[model samples]
Target: MSKIDSSLFMSPVKQIVIGNIRKDTTIEDLKDCFSQLIKKHDVSFRIAVDKKGKQKGFAAVSIPITLVNDFLNYNGRNMKGHRITVVLSEDFKISKSTRWQQEETGVFKTPSPNQYNSLRSMPFLYKLFDAGVYLTHPKFSKNALNVIERAQSCGVKKMVVLGANVHQCEQALGLCRLFSGSLFCTAGLGPKHAPFWTDEAETQLTQIASSGHCVAIGECGLDLSTDELSSSQSQQLYAFEKQIQLSIKLKKPLVVIEKQAHIETLSLLQKYKDQLVDVVVSFVPENKAQIVKYVQEGFYIYIHGNVFLPQNSCIKKWLTDSDEETNVPFDRLLLGSAAPYHSVFRCTDIDWYPRQFTDDTQHKSFDIMLKHCKDNYSEPCSLPSMLVMMCCMVGDRFTPRSLAEKLTQNAVTFFHLDKSVGEEASVKVTGEKFCNKTPASHHRRWSFFVVTALVVVAAVVLLGVVCVKYSVLDKVGALYNLL
Candidate 1:
């Protein structure tokens, strides 16, 4: 309790909470105690008191926002023979999303940097959800759980691991099982794989699509950009229509992909407009007019990490020009990284997709991944990085806080991800779940591995005992010398 006045409050300042003040402590005593550390005398302290005006063991200390970290060092230190706790109050989140909003390089206004140096340092800023991520793709296949953990560490509470085919869908499901509540997924055959959309693949995909864990249908759409991997245009259209029908039957949204096949893609979408529940386009087309058409058709626009690239001028214009009636609406916009596909990734494609992971090498996975990163790009594309870039692109139209809320809500509503985690209970996926793998088989395999490990350990111990009993160490040493 400072002696000057009872109501000393600071605005635009971080409040540091100091606790465990003794009842006898007064304004002068506290000032003298803290004056050495903060000698400027501009900082203020307010101790909460009981009805009887007795010390209430905690006080709100307002210091220069920059000095918060320095003042935090007093935590757990002896103060009047008592260990006091010092911590930052929940004051930094006023403009949580706005703090991380960055403008394009050489452009700045509305959103300035926060007290923290990096976007990752802003704890509350990480809550923005990443709508799409290829978490089970080759780029992240080594440590399947590693990428998910990293994403969650930075405050990405939710993510959708999209699959381009049935196996990949199962793979996403397998990985998602480890991070149940936070991860959702989609099951669909991409247009490139349209040729393989056999009845069995369709049946498998349909089964996978039924899971409550599966939020939407498709990575399926028209892709005219492929040469070797892409199916014929007609086949792509056929697969797209079928998937749209599937989405209609399942009543789930469609997570679509498109590359240079805009006219055909839109036509098929129009053909099924009445039956389709929802549609999410992964990439923005170059034609601004086509964008208007897609928006008019109620397709949710996905803003990927690549929007900042010079080639995506149309998307940039569409996003920044909020006043345009034909522009993609904020409510219909979603954010994705399509990561490992993003430019930040150093991926060499064999087909349209990144090189698949093959477990042929028996070495340290980290070393291989590290070498891959060094050879290609420095860091794998992360959700948080995409969030930063997208916010920067949209910062011109909206504040970071407002934009973050809009995008977050868009993803939530688009995917229906707000459904209860236990909702998967309602629709049980019957056909071989997670590809052909089952939970019982997984546990049985693990049990076998454990038994084998125990046997190996026992054998090693027996061999060591026999060697020691027979003096094999001396014999081996002598034999080595003789050799």
Candidate 2:
């Protein structure tokens, strides 16, 4: 191939290979971070990988030809804590003899050194992973897969699938397996599945925890919207307690779904506070005291889709007050789509639809909104675009980048997904085993001893009383014979 003029690299689809990318970094992460460099243009990114499926520490990104110069100017920027080297396709192929080649060359050429240095250095940008959606479970497995695929494309990489029961837990895990992206799941009986426990339920959950798919035991807590009798209340409490212990035994975090019974849930959590690994309390409580208590306990507070609604004044107040006074640090905050279920108030929930399609009111999906942005449309905001604005408004330091990165980091750390890939594979759970040990092993041992002692004392007392009664009856019989 003759020396191809660098001008051809400026076509609507330009190829730039990014180097030194972390192994865990995905194509979605790259697109999310790099898109910010040229928000005015439409870009599609895909990473190069070896046959083994491990990232080759480099990626090829194609952006609008008009913005090729803009991306080329961003050559030496940092992404996900790594300073990367961006190279043009022609230069890369000439240097490495790679497969990517072009036969057509235009007058476009690399900028002169004087001209390049004259261009201002890219701003000191901070880049990190995209925000995670904490709970997402569509009614159908196919729907769940669709949401996951779209979510991954939109830079929503991490997600937690909520399992209200064994069937749901199975479905959630199935979805996790389907997504080539990273995902964590929580398995346990939620309040809705409570008070109707079967003997096989715990066994099924034991298998779930052992399956290595579950990272948390939750969506389990009290919900007392009905006027139930004492027996029903006992069942709900028993269900929650059982899952709480299961969480401790399995050494997993607990995702508490609190409703009208905040106080009861709090008290129960306090009782097992030392045993649990980590706690994430979902849903917004109207009472500020509950928020304070949860914060003081070092629990993560999940902000759901309601925060995007115009009617959720409480959520707004909480996000606004998420500073020194509230003790709600950015790292302690999390975001979730909670798809298919919005609060009583109207809010934007993520759903699947035709590609580039909008709702009845022209509210488009996040991916579609990105297209509008690329076209430079200045129409009224859509739900997806509103979410971006919401992130800026509610995030720490009131910046979109900070909030997105912080929430993603929080999810990754809480689930312990930062470990080595080999470690992750080695510890993969099969859900066949039960918790033979736990952080609360000492407490369980003491409990067994105490119960054994009480039973022994009761038996000894009953034996003594019986012997005394027999002696008295014998004395009465002797006296009657003497008479």
Candidate 3:
């Protein structure tokens, strides 16, 4: 598929063709399996069975170019029992393209534990969670249900359901109702390449917000990339303002989607600063100053696993430096795997870049902040202390025990969630383990041993050097005296 130049104002339809199914797999079964992958992303494609009525164990899925980029950056690596392959199907010539194309989908391969551990050891990337993503059309009820089931099976307690269409919203609500405490939905209007939300859409959103099921007020924001359904600066502003105001009025948090309209979005946000709660900046900025400005303003930096980006990019440098001084706290940092949708943004046959950052870098980042916190905060400083500092400095000043708690608080306080439902939805996420081991204790046990070894080596070298210098000096002094 042709690269959808995000720099240009063109909306390209990026497709993911899943092939090599186990021939006997029925369309319903295939759909059931693939539905979970697409529900959390913005995709446009249909499912079809081959002539043999057997599951080819492959699928051809097309997603919005933006989503494709996200998928490739985050969750493009492994799926199910298969290391799912991603291919460009747009240029392929197929005799019968019955929604399903016969393109060569790569074989399924799972990484061994050693491979997983080795990959983890590479740099700063750590396995935060095994995320189960769902990408669904707002109208697909059955698909939504399947996704919820799949997420549960995968131990994914947190979920993000894309699209703001009424049916999708309803399906989301249904999932929340069924799962009760397990599921939470992020209401979004999608990109400019796709349909924008209408006033009726707002009403439905408002209704959903009132239901206590909807936690955040977006996947709604601006996308200047797609020319297919272009949005003017004014239109984007108007939409953003409406959602912001809705969030404020409903007392719910807002999730923004921005692409190339950073300045405009920030300007508008500053204009209505009081109304906006938490902001998740999806794409990392190229400019260092802009990142600092956002961090200073208090926005959680959502880092995606994109191969093109380095672990110690300028942003990470800024984060490291910023942590030392209390310029911005560490609790505000959050990691998200922008999965399923990222499958299409592959260059060669490879899809989904491995998670970014090395294990050492990841540990160092955390360690530096912990040390800083220990030195600065009082004795009562707990993990929550670190989390609170991080959240307030880097992200919004609200840190709940779990994602669910945060979502519930966001829902009740920002969205005017139904009183009863909101109360029931409330939960407490487990706190991070606090290290009570003192520095002195660590020093005595480990630092002393290290220092002693170093001192012994240094003493030996110093003695050898002194002996040689004294021997030469003594001979020279005797000759001078004799003269």
TM-scores, in order shown?
0.55, 0.53, 0.45
| Highest-scoring model, TM-score | 1
- Top model by lDDT, which number? 1
**Model 3 whole-model lDDT (C-alpha atoms):** 0.46
Residue-wise C-alpha lDDT for candidate 2, range 354-431, written one tens digit per residue: 332333322323434444322212111122343454554564554544555566567666766544321144122211
- For residue 128, give model 3's deviation from the true position in Å: 6.6
lDDT of 1: 0.62
Once fitted onto the true fold, the runs of candidate 2 whose alpha carbons sit more than 4 angstroms away are: 1-138, 228-231, 343-345, 348-389, 420-483
lDDT string, candidate 3, 1-483, tens digits: 334333311122344554444444444554465565567754433334445443345555555544554444423444445554455443332323233432244222222111111121122221122111233442222243333333232223344444444555555565554344444566545555234557887887788777665676665666775563353655666777787888778666666667766787678778877556676565556566766766677765544333123442555455445454445343454433343332212212111112222334433433332343222121111122222222332334333235323332332333233344533634333222111124344567798899999999999999879879789668878999999
Regarding TM-score, does 1 or 2 come out ahead? 1
lDDT for residue 29 in candidate 2, whole number 0-100: 77
True-vs-predicted CA distance for residue 159, candidate 3, Å: 2.5
Clashes of each: 0, 10, 56
Q: Indicate the residue-level lDDT of 409 in model 2.
A: 66
What would the TM-score be for candidate 3 when compared with the true structure?
A: 0.45
